[model samples]
Target: MDIFTGPKLRDFKNSPPHLQFNKYVLTGYRPISTYRDCLQSLFYLHNEFGNIYTHGIPFICFLLVLPLSIPWAEIEWWIGVVHYLACLSPTICSVFYHLFMNHEGGAPIYDTLLCFDMFGVCLVNTLGALPIVHITLLCYPSSRLVATLAYLLLSGYGVHCAVSAQSNVHRLQSFAWQAIFRFFLFMLRLTGAGRGSPASLRLYLTMDTLALLGGLVNISRLPERFSPGRFDYWFNSHQIMHIMVVLSIVYLHWGTLEDLTWLKGYHCPGE
Candidate 1:
């Protein structure tokens, strides 16, 4: 019988207690349907908990491969090191956050853990821009001042975002917004705006601002929260937020490729 048909429901009700109990136990250990619920579910043993642990392996592998493919001078090895460290920061913090965040007795420790989680987000966001900024500045020496300042600002924001006493929902929203803003700013540069030029920098700042706003709107889940559980598995606000983040990263990488192409057309610093 089709699982969705009425007969299935009738059969399920009439099934023997032993079989029903076994099925219920198996299903009970499965993951929760929502993002927030998944975080909460981490404290207990479940099939999804292991899946989540395995999710970071690919990212870690990519980080390892990055250095092998690109020479240090071409992309600056130290910057890649910083970016790699930053990327891992958030993942590590998240593991700990989910593991122990539910202990109600240690309010102070929980608060500290939340701070670390925020720090991780900020680190990942700022670090994402480092390699791009470094290459662009190298390609266009005139923009060094502007690039440095932008880097400082981005790095500072990451630190602030990490340490701030904000709720997880708010932090996640902020991260999504920042990633989106970075995406548009990069688009402007890829179109031929001079590095660190006033117009380009203004566009970049505007992009970041827009991203912050977007993050807030997404995390709050305003319209959907009005009807809970309706968008649990699909078409929900968080999924939109994740899509935006992935898009932003793609845009950043594209902008970097454009910078590399531009550099290839010109002679290197001493040549």
Candidate 2:
């Protein structure tokens, strides 16, 4: 199936300068193609095929199967909705960005796709943590509202920084504020100063840790840097980051589910 066959891919130097963000991925760069051609690339082998499929498969799974796993009837309606979207957002944007990155329109198209990709990540970080705030500050209504509002404001800055950033390092830096805010919430749960599923703290930690590591890995260009060109089509740093991003989202979902379940049986001091 030349569904598996295609035009010979270019080396990193041969690929567009903008798309050569990772010099270590020295070959298999897709040629600039029409949107339809990009769509067709889905069936072929390329460096980004793995990136596209890694997120693509998870996006579909979350869209179709996550609802069954979620305690929709038991959890707050909006929480379920937000969580669902948060779980799905990054992948939806990432698949499109990675697939069409080599669009015939060139760097402008790539930049736009990159912005959209960043926005998706911002959405996941912002939307995913709102419910955690609500649950953690459940007892203190005033504080809950304040914390949620503050976190949202912080995330707004994150989105701005992320979408407008000039480099990968800056892009990852944009998420630091949001991550710090989440760490505070995690501390609350840890110290019993706030409330949540105690079991979830570990999951949340794993989530953040994997996400941070993924970002660093992308920036540092690990295994790929060790052997330029060998990992051009598979196991490249960016691909590894994509996989880690999915795993982080999974942990986010697991931790959220634990909190929702605990919320059902628990109450605040005043309640």
Candidate 3:
């Protein structure tokens, strides 16, 4: 409850250089802090407070609440496991990255956290779609195996590019291959070459759309670009991106659940 009586906040000009990525966010920056001080900042009002809580609350909710909705016993065990991890990974890693980004360790710590955050995104991209691939190519075991392996290879490349990326645009670009491959899967579903819950394709499309939009908005730094300093503490491009990312995850969950339910009764042409 209101930890440390609100440490004095700084402006963009005074913030650590690493935290100055968004020049439009002209105020409400937290100073470089010790580990304990960073934790204490959680209770105080700062620009990052919105970023931390936006993903932090969802991480807690997903960790506790999503499992209850998952049919862990009904589906292929691995599908359930991957889906659970995919749903939880991004937000938890994001919470950590945002929460301690300004630690006294400075850029090295920040870079490590950024990589950790990218790894979480990588996990979701890699793990989340194993089920979709498994279900889509269910009728063709050989094709399913090849597609799954291909996607894994692509995701590995993406992870390398993302963690090593020097800018936000490059980080967003790193996931392009995986997204394109997913688009191919969606096309298969649309053409009836791949099979899933018919409803799922739409949800999956929406999921990707939201994610792409979020990345573009973040890269463009919109609204904030239009009015600097106005959204320093909330509703800025990054916060908006965070909200969109959460919604995209929800869509992914809904789509996967649809596919799983459809899987319960469907079979290959001869099996």
Candidate 4:
């Protein structure tokens, strides 16, 4: 078959059993494909098409645009690099996972890609907040050290749970501790007990809200659930979640930028 013309698509029931997680998506499944064939699927219309591009296009845009906006020379070396990686990690992993999910390697490959995709999410949750922690505790070095270590330990647990999760709910639950930790930090900022840009707290909150909503929508399978087969090609819950995740990352970037700018001019009462 010509790569451009693409292979004949299958229905959800006829697709590989592992890929049938969404029963509502009744059509437009790509058959088990080779590496080249999977790449070619990018050009054709199918159920996974929106999933691939929603994150794929953002991955390209973020890769090219994020660095230019980061103040690398003005900030701590690790902060700038870690934030950039955090911003890029989820989208790129998602792109690859959605793109190659139908590879001939089958279920095992799909599982591995799923884990990789989960790890990308874990990376953002882990790395994205390091700066927040650093700034929130700027006035207390000892507390900052302890909090940073504690968060990393909690994040390790979150990563393990996320990759091993059997359901979307479980995957969403895996991040609860991290979210709670962030909430505590946000509380400190809100109460003026911790340090950070006042504006950033709201952005971070919005980011988390969108991410949570995305997970809930994916698990609930809304819209598609309401009208099965209607969303087999576009605006399915997964694609909606992908777009939400991208927006969440954008808010993360905006919040981090606000904090970073605040960090440049602000200092502790004594130092």
Candidate 5:
């Protein structure tokens, strides 16, 4: 019997090699299979140098929002949902931008996608900050004007950051700039500058300025830039920036929580 004409031979030839050899073996050949490939590819050096960091944002944001779901009588469930959604948006946008923006012949599309990612970050950050400020003010009527003004200014600054960031090619650099803006605001708060108390405000400002400077130092990537690839997988500037961002968000959240707690002790205007 000629093998060429054999039914078994024909079937064998038609079958994929992996399947023919071992049907139980799962070979991921689909487009979505590339996710596993990406995981494996992490160990290797390729164009996806900063891809992990790009994808990690959403994961971290999810973790950040998770705790907010914990029981808090004053915090409406709807508000938690909104906060979660807002926090997740930037991460989702960032992941998509990183995943597809590097496709061949897609530079313009990449730029547009990245712009959306930046905008998402700005919008989400602004959204997250506003609700907290509003809720805080609702608790502390005496601080209503200050909180409202702060919220408006921060929102405006966020919009400015988004626009400026879109115009810049270096996304990380743009993030650093935004961090500086936030640090300035944080400094003002620390100094009691919003309440018109010079002495107390100065002391607070000093502390905030120090924190901001530390954040800047981490974000600037000075030592790493001086020696390319030296701190690639470990303590690079971008990594430091991410850490600082997480810290800043945590601090802001805690501050809001504290304010809310204090407000709960007081009667709003006339109880």
Candidate 6:
């Protein structure tokens, strides 16, 4: 079971420059590794071990189980499809990024992986909200169409900002417009102009709150920063954020499912 038969690990300072992003994680950094060496890492313990499995296990579970829970046949098939992809994207993208971050290909590859990780988050941010938008404007056909198009346009710009952002805070900020847009929709739902299960609004609110908290925790680097090297292979800020991100996705799924099920009984006024 021990595939890490060779290639000793490095310290924080010894790791590749790009891999030194976290000073709090002062040890257990994987060295510049070939493709095979990266694969071998799965069997051994390292700083990224927790990161890899935290998202990796959920990715597999979501892949296998979400489709069964989804209303694929009962609802508009596209909504269910998008929901499924939205649930799975962040985890899979994260797994790859964490797994190969120390690759011999170096910073360019690391940056590409970082872009991919951000892309996954953007997918969830964009596609996950489509159903909410659709349901909110279900009665107002014209507004639904316009809002959907506008949201997609906003998401497109968000993706560009996120991928190009040079800092963590900027990448988090890139999502501000989309979050504001979603908040507007939630307000509409609250005011009864928008339609959805009453329970779903609270779930969506919790989803965003957890995600925002996770982002802030990552940017601020708490707990780990307070005691460097103590959490190198365990409950560090990034790992904590990863857990929060997963929880946030669960809420997104719950809220969307609540709305989707509620959809079966509701019709727009005047329709």
lDDT by candidate, in order shown: 0.48, 0.92, 0.92, 0.94, 0.48, 0.94
Residues 66-167, candidate 5, lDDT per residue (tens digit)? 566434677665555555555566556766655554333344565676677677666555555554445434645557667657656756666565655633
lDDT of 5 at 237: 55
Instruction: State, as a TM-score between 0 and 1, how close model 3 is to the true structure.
Output: 0.98
Clashes by residue pair, model 6: none
lDDT for each residue of candidate 3 in 1-271, tens digit (9 for 90 to 100): 3485677789999888988999999999888889888899888889999999999998898999888888887888899899999999999999999999999999999999999999998998889989999988888889999999999999999999999999999999999999999999999999999999999999999999999999999999988999999999999999999999999899999999999888888878877
Weakest lDDT window of 10 consecutive positions for candidate 6: 1-10
TM for every model, in the order presented, reads 0.55, 0.97, 0.98, 0.99, 0.56, 0.98
User: What is candidate 1's lDDT per residue for 163-248, written digit by digit as tens?
Assistant: 77355464554455445545644654567552423333443444355445445656567444665544433444534443343344
- Superposed model 1: Cα runs more than 4 Å off: 1-74, 139-142, 165-191, 195-218, 222-271
Error of 3 at 11 (Å): 1.0
Q: Residue-pair clashes per candidate, as listed? A: 4, 1, 0, 0, 3, 0
Indicate which candidate wins on TM-score: 4
Superposition TM-score, candidate 1 onto the true structure = 0.55
Tell me the alpha-carbon RMSD of every candidate.
Answer: 10.4, 1.3, 1.2, 0.7, 12.4, 1.2
Worst 10 residues of 2 by lDDT: 1-10
TM-score of 4: 0.99
**In model 6, what lDDT does residue 41 have?**
93
Kindly report which residue stretches of model 6 are placed more than 4 angstroms away from their true locations once superposed. 1-6
Output the lDDT of residue 247, model 6.
Answer: 98
